[model samples]
Target: MASTLTRLGAGILSKFGRSVASPTRLQSRPYYLYSPEPFHPIPDKQPLCMTADEAVTVVTSGMRIFVHGCAATPIPLLDALARYGKEAKLHNVELIHIHTEGPGILAQPEYDGIFRCNNLFIGANCREAVNAGRADFTPIFLSEIPNLFRRKIWQLDIALIQVSPPDNHGFCTLGPSVDCTRAAIQNAKYIIALVNPNMPRTFGDGVIHMSHCDVVVTGTDPLPVISQHCCSEEEEQIGRLISENLVQDGATLQMGIGSIPDAVLSKLYGHRDLGVHSEMFSDGIIDLVNKGAITNAKKTIQTGKIVSSFAFGSKKLYNFMNNNPSVVFNDVAFVNNTAVICQNPKVTALNSCIEIDLTGQVISDSIGTKMYSGVGGQVDFIRGAALGLDGLGKPILAMQSQTHKGSSKIVPFLKQGGGVVTTRAHVHYLVTEYGIAYMFGKNLRQRAYELIKIAHPKHRECLEKAAFDRLKVMPCP
Candidate 1:
């Protein structure tokens, strides 16, 4: 296995070299027997539109398939695949993707043997299947997902995608989610697209000529929209602390979706020349962009563009991204690359965690033995921001002091079976409603004291006692 992986790595490096030399290059050798011609917009040739059933007929048993994920999941294509699996009794079909939103019919218990999901990031839709041993999850960084397909580590037979209709030039956009779908489309043996009029015609590397798609099915279903909740007073307070204490003017930002990130963006109205280069962003950024707060003027990379791999938000957010030249959607590998991210000046990476120990270990993916979320791009952005040019970047982990049930999120040690997504060496700034805890360059005892200081007042005493009992360090009264 080691030797095989080594060979694959070498082959990828060779291809990478060739690709850098020639941007319009194609693979010299095909993974499958059928190889489509180079993509070019055919001005006069009309597309052969078909029904969902007709498109699904091309799928055969034992073929590896790629499903577009997130809000852009191809529902029509997925439903067709499920129906086909049931009607044809297909077996050994592998479905690969990241966190997808929706029912995920292929992952249903009835299709256990017909379709097996290999997920990079597990979502609520497939969590039950994974836990029940009907599906499998591969713990990996979002930054490296595109590499798996681009490098041919996993040769895909079919690519199922949801895209906007072709324009005058016969080019269609991959819409809101582009993370690894671009790579999948480029590498897959056959491309099956669910062309939807509702999918936003987003700009950037997401645009592809219609000639690349082998089968196209038109649908009118509304694209999924994820709404953001109003941040609580405590969350707002934490956001203020982070914005005032850590975020600087002209800083580049990397943040994820949620209430905390929303609160932080709300507080950044006064900041100047702010830039966004996150793995994923939500509706909070739209207001900032409209107010000229996020000018993207001072970023070292993509200086005047909002760079992101994927986006999730309301219908308004989707409409805002349509044909927007300022927003540049790229693949996850480039958007989340640590080296590429640190090129920007004063990169501030805002992330959240499930829980953290006094020693500064972060548990962001799993809760005890249960997989809550995947280790998406926390470490990628954290390390990138920490190593920012000339110490201007900052990695801030923000969360509430207590859970909804009033339990302290700060603990003496991580719960058993909870994996550490970020280690002590990587943790720098920890923020809560109370205050900020600067953990960089601090010893274990000092870290414990600092963390306990920012913990909820009701739990501070108990946390200090636990730290003393575990680390044999006296608490500072």
Candidate 2:
């Protein structure tokens, strides 16, 4: 088992080396067939109810297991799995998922041979393991992750998920997360579910019958709580600029997590009939919903409903979505589809970046050689909003002018290994606290000059010098 893991890890490291060397040549490879799956689930069979420790006994060495992510991350099952694997002397049991939370013991160096993580989208919990070369990172768009399962690109042996308890007629829902779970369950040979009463009974593509479950473990874990973001002064300024200049009263919105997004949402209370169609949303939207700003009435698609793939936020946010027909959690394959997102009017996609080069190349996934987060839905919404139906769509990239360490985020060139998640060709608007830089249809010099104007005042002169050196043209009025 150890030898098999070494062979697989070497293959991934070699591929990762090439990806770092020539990013264009890097191709994504999900978990390969470690070994043959011996067990096949029977049809129309009732699930065997068991404790967490007993339910996890079905997992074995050399099998790829998909762990549920986000607010619905199964704590009890994972803790039990950790204990069981250590006690049973397990090895080479690979775990795959997107940005799950909790004190991720399984991905640490201590669990090297016992448990390994294959991350589709890296998160804070797994960031250290990924950077230390303990876990593997796959850079794929959220829109396409479903195909890995639905098309059998990645063979799954088991899917570990958490869900709301069974309703009358024995129906259970995937709750807050429905992004890729549907596809995972359809392809997995067996399913193990944790029935948590705290999981919100959401509406959309997350429905499953109890008969589909191979093993069921009951839990009463509370959803992980994220406190509401208090926007900084710079973030507030960016929010105001976007709200006043870019977002229309009836615009359909797409925003990612963090303080800037929350700030933008804070400023939108006056906007009317605004709709949300994002890959994921946080607690920011709850206030807008309360203030009658997010009526979802004017959206061209999914009228009168807020369409999202998954949600992560405070308990207040979850409570608002509980059994609420207005908030729909669908699969990302459909929700983040460019065609689907473009159908709406004034599609305003608000995204952030780690840094952006003078030529408008935006890097969000990594800093230099380290992978911080994954390219989840930045391109999905950026391209979607760029092709918006009414031509009023705005794809705005907002970030602070300078980092906390006083380094310029708008640079002459991207750091050597930064992943260009949004290309210069796709960039429309770049915002800083100073002002907005409209990059669409701009010449190289013009783009640099505009970006420099909004850069931190202290760095503008150096940026000008650097721009002249790189572009070989004086950015003059």
Candidate 3:
């Protein structure tokens, strides 16, 4: 202990008024100390158990609360929080987080008078609120989320989380979601955890000792289930084209979750020595992993391991990751770091967006003045894929050329106030159902012409008129 403290850099120790040095594992309270074997829950309950109502009292009015994200969300606890908010006018309590699954009860119109979500990442659960202007959005990188908590910028008043039942050693697991929960749990003033039995005992920086938890609520509710959306014919064709373009035996890959990503993964059945180090993964990657396609043999960073921060899919995906060693679920800060992603050669990032302007301004989060999704790790992987000092690399952004209502997705200009999630400088390749368009180093007029060629045939004439009107050129620049 003395030597460890002496070796401290003094900056962390002085700022936090505590030791910055890491203590010996045996000396420090081991998060998993009571475990005679892994996967075994504690035999007896401790003294900190409380009813749902009692737990809700901790959250006062006008407070800033952080909820656990992804599969680790505590649904019962959030329901209780909503109940309390209804009973006691808990107005102005700001809700902050990335996309959390399940029905966003707090974001509904009934609770609009009390809870105002400042969503950092808009998910389907909170889409209506954002589109209706009842909630707000923040466009930022996922890697920088922890800094907000550590620097006391957000100043979280309470953190609501869910975890696996404690092991024999009195340490609980953070389960499927660890992205920003570790930082939130460490920095919040009061921490309330719902100790659930069904939460997967995931490995990583997700363990918490019994002493660190201020309140524990025993619950038996099942974790939220994620449904897989199927790929359309257009997506399948685009996926085939995208897959055909890839060179056999390429090392690294990064892809966001969706039908197109699944389609692309399905197309890579015959490819050899592929790897995955993505922000998230779906059931598509599972089949590839089973077939030995994703051996992680060619990856430069975290070699020989499938890496991701979180995952959402059917029961098959959850069951596969339950006790799997091949998948290493780390935090978003590490998984989505551009520098780390760039280290892996032939990094291909497959991302989706709502619209792309003629000049290559990608907007994935909104529908023309309506906010849809938050900026969540698209630019991180895109820029990382573009860091091809090797000269043979290309960063690809994939999206359908048209929306479901037959509206054009490739626009002459972004809708006013639409966020430019990806800048023109970072864009390289754009793929749609029609074909692929290379926009790197192209002038404004050439870029417009190439993108229009990929736009849906029904919208092409109108798009051409808009492009020529904007650029003031006869045909196109």
Candidate 4:
């Protein structure tokens, strides 16, 4: 097996070298394929059921632990661990993750002395802790996080996971959360699971046999539900306009969580042969898939597969994916690579932004100097769409024209100290409720004009003044 992997790696390296030497063939050779599946799961002897307290007891002082990501968070176990933080006097137990759902008591100030958060991706629950200096972040590509574990770079001591009840064959699915859990389970010295019948049994490389869990916490809790926030009339209009621009039979689609994405999906019922290759999805795409709009029929990569790293939605979405071959839950490392993403022809990566400057710098992860979301798979799929073959397509940055407070999102400059999640050069299409601005090769002045045209009428004059002041362009007085 090692010899085979080595040879495969060498072949990939050689191909990469050839691509660097010749750019034309690079486009032709770009396609996605999976490595052969690993053998059926190897089960350990005698899997024991235990309470949440018993499950967390394996974690000791100064140990590094990985928590399950997205909706499949082991909430009962994590809350129990927080309670254990007091009883066991567990000090310096570090919790690392991209994002998790639930109370996240471990991130509270009371547990600061006992637990430290090393966030790979910051979500709202841990945002305060991260900003308060109780936590720190590791800025790495989503595609490389699993490698950190596989290479023993992070050295996981324990993993807290939630899984479905064992099937007839004794294999348990990772449920709705599979992004980093596979790596955590493989790398951790000990694995503890919360087994809930309520958790859906998902398909793909997201399973482990009952015997593999060192200790299992049998708990009954409804899987957490995340419904789509309603899309405003303006958002719906934006979505409709963007959908109108889509090719009649585009083959691949990549969308993230939020109203804009939900809005976009809401308008795609008429389109055909749509495919999904995204980091995560919510309730919006269910109708499309059910209506046979998303057939995944024409995709060159993962053909006929709904490929994603994680999922967040109501129980309905969960039920649909349970044991469903239509969905393949893989690691972020594999799902978010730009090279793999563009293989599906007409890949339209519709991502959101916190705000965008006139010059097209996207500040999606931060507000001014403070961190909000992390540097996710945005750039990965964006570049993938831009470089896709046959002049096929480009990524879309979608957002509303104005903030809830009526402030414009399109500005002459990003807020001071804000991080640029997407560079100016990479932005291809910027869409708002008003219209789309194609700024792929536009100069700074031209970008400013295009962006301002879509800015809310209330803020247009202000932005124009700012741009004029900064660029020394004569204002139309």
Candidate 5:
């Protein structure tokens, strides 16, 4: 058996123009054979397990460090870095990541000079820092973030990641957040992993051999959980309309976390063979999979598998994903690629917006100039779904007709300085509790009329007058 395995390892290395000295049996379990690249041999030296503070000493001044984001964020490492930076008076230590949860101690005012943040996606923790000019926000699609590292546009010196413990084959999984962290792990000069037993061992592109990690710190804290909230009456109504009208059987779905998406998923219990190819998902998807509602039977891409880049929800969701081969966690670049997403049949991309103008302009990431969130994979999936195979797919934008303050979300014009995450041309289906409006290829005047019809009852009259005045057309009967 040892001789046979040595031959197999040698054959893989030879194909990559590399050689290993006497392939030793590193672990009992077989190496995963899915990734296209050849698996490098495990190092002879065992990984040094240490405390968070000791492992973080590898991070030096002026280094660009990548932090794993979302549910898989390495909190212990981040906290240690914060303490070390302040004590050592470290300067110009740049931290980069997508949206992360928790208090974000590094982004606090006291760490202004010691630790600087370059956020790819602004979450609640970093919003104040970005607005206060203590940190910076990068407006880019989630699909393009991996390329930024792979192409060496933003070279990373170190990567702080949280991962599952090494399986028998000496392989550790990145757990919930494969996303950009896969690229960071591959490209970064050094890797410091927080080995947490609580993290689910998800399969696919997130799996990495422990030989890749330079240092490992034990962390057993519970993974952060974002509970599902009940949708309001209006949101429930809109969700029902979308599930009934737009979502068809065998449709591939891409949706974010929120009450509206949860409401939509709840209503899809009766739908057949639904597939998910989303950037991120929450607990709602687990129910659908268990009920056999999402068989992925008719998907054109990765058929029979639920593909996602990351996940965050209740502990039940993580437990559902633990060592589950049915759910394949991949990098965001592959999951959110326009070309890849378009391959799936009936690709329905459901996204939300902060506000939208009468002419179909979407404001999602920011309210006027203030950055509320990041320009995520909304455009990528929208454009991909719009061009679905044989034109069977649809991109739906669903939001409440009005804010909690009773202000209209559908306006005559977007607030001044608002960022248009989705342009007029990319918007296809717009939904509110009032009804659905198809806006693609419609003239400005026609769009205004269609949008006003779906506005809240109290705001329709004022919206119509503003539309008529701006569009210079007679009010529709």
Candidate 6:
């Protein structure tokens, strides 16, 4: 201990005060002990700043670049890249990111081979491009994305990120996004950051020193904001079924963004001490915090803090995260780890799917052969909750009984080429506006009966007939 402290730089020793520093893990918190308090390390030198156009000048053809994603997307840099690419006639400049929000021109026909996008998870901005074959999507678990960069599988030449201004000690936070961007910086040859004062300074594994940036672009662009989703009557009914029946007090939650998620969270105000350990979150959680429903007191890990990899929401939600100690943003790799997720009690992973077959096969990422979205972190949290520490976890899949076109979502067979994001074995609880179905340990015939019970009333007869044909036994409900 004496030798380790002797090796410590005077700056860290002085700033850290009485906090013990372990040599094995030289961070704000020791390996054995961790708190949600924000920490900053002093830097010996500050990095120089440059204009957005000048920063992209380092890009050469055939270089793969990683763009920061979610609400933390660097809008100005991306816009500048598009302009500079056309001007310089740059070709084969591959861009990688997950669910970014900005000018969607990179994948347009005009840019074409100049700037090609490879989305780890498709968002609205690039969905059309991916489907059109102008852009590409990689279907992988969100938890393993970091390995793609770190292990040099998808070697990155440059990393573009958005961050808050450097603190007094010259440390800037990665703002709302940490996930794979952190790993990108760790391995990328060049690191470019857009310093946006409007980006919220969040805590957890996102802090970086300005000295680490190869080039910095200063901008004050406001982060993109998504308004709250209003739930439909059917969505509201689905929410009530999950919230009232499955969501218990002291449960840890993992959910995505949508009317179904919004509906579920809307009804969680009556619960007590509910915890959040999700890959990402949106404005829906803000109300639960306001209503005193999400106190995080009952969580066995990271007690008293809402844990997430990133967030995307309205200005109100961003304000709630700025320098807020109660919220701890972490790396998506750790946040979605089944081992970490199952450490908590009653982890309810509330999710939605595009469709489900009678035998419990789920299709979420595609409509038949055409890709609609990338496979996100659904399987991670689903398996995590299925193995919850206290033995009462719920892995639930919820959706409306019928598609927007009035077709039954519960079918006897998945679409001819539909991608199954979650398989039959991983499934446990399935919810719909009509009711809930528990599928764990059930045979094919039994699972079909439960699913038909919760399917739309108009489609039940057809589903029943289809089930008997498939199961070779009468599926009576």
lDDT of 4 by residue, 1-477 (tens): 223223222122233332322213212111112321221444224344556765565666788889997889889999888987888788998998988888778999999989988888898889999899988777767777888887878887777888887765667888887887787777676677788888888877688765556566778888888854777898898898888885457658888888888888888899999988888888888899999899999888788989998998898888888878889988778888877887778989898998998778998888898989888888988988888874686689988888889989998778998989899999999999888898987888888888888888899889998988877883331
> Candidate 3 residues 1-477, lDDT tens each?
112212321122234222211112112113446521222332332324566666666666787889898777788888988898988777898988888887899999999868988888988889888888888888888877877887878888777888877665667777778777777776776667788877877776677755466567778877777675778999998898788885356657788778888888898979989988888887788888889888999888778888888777766777787767777777688888887888886888888888999878999888778888878888888887888545444578898888889888898888897888899888888999999988888888888888998999988888888888888874353
lDDT by residue for model 1 (14-107), tens:
3323232221222332423454322454433333456776677667788888999998998888998899888988898999999888798888
In candidate 2, what are the lDDT values of residues 324-400, reduced to their tens digit?
Answer: 99999998899999999999989999999999988899999999999999999999999999998889999989999
Best by TM-score: 5
RMSD after CA superposition, every candidate: 9.0, 10.0, 8.5, 11.3, 6.8, 8.2
Error of 3 at 283 (Å): 1.2
lDDT of 4: 0.79
Off by over 4 Å in 5: 1-39, 475-477
Please state the error at residue 328 of candidate 5 in Å.
0.3
Cα lDDT, model 6, residue 3:
24
Q: Answer with 1 or 3, whichever has the higher TM-score.
A: 1
- Judge candidate 3 against the unseen true structure and give its global Cα lDDT, from 0 to 1: 0.76
TM-scores of the candidates in the order shown = 0.90, 0.91, 0.87, 0.89, 0.91, 0.91
Where in model 3 is the C-alpha error above 4 Å? 1-47, 388-393, 474-477
Name the lDDT of candidate 5.
0.85
Q: What is the lDDT of residue 53 in candidate 4?
A: 66
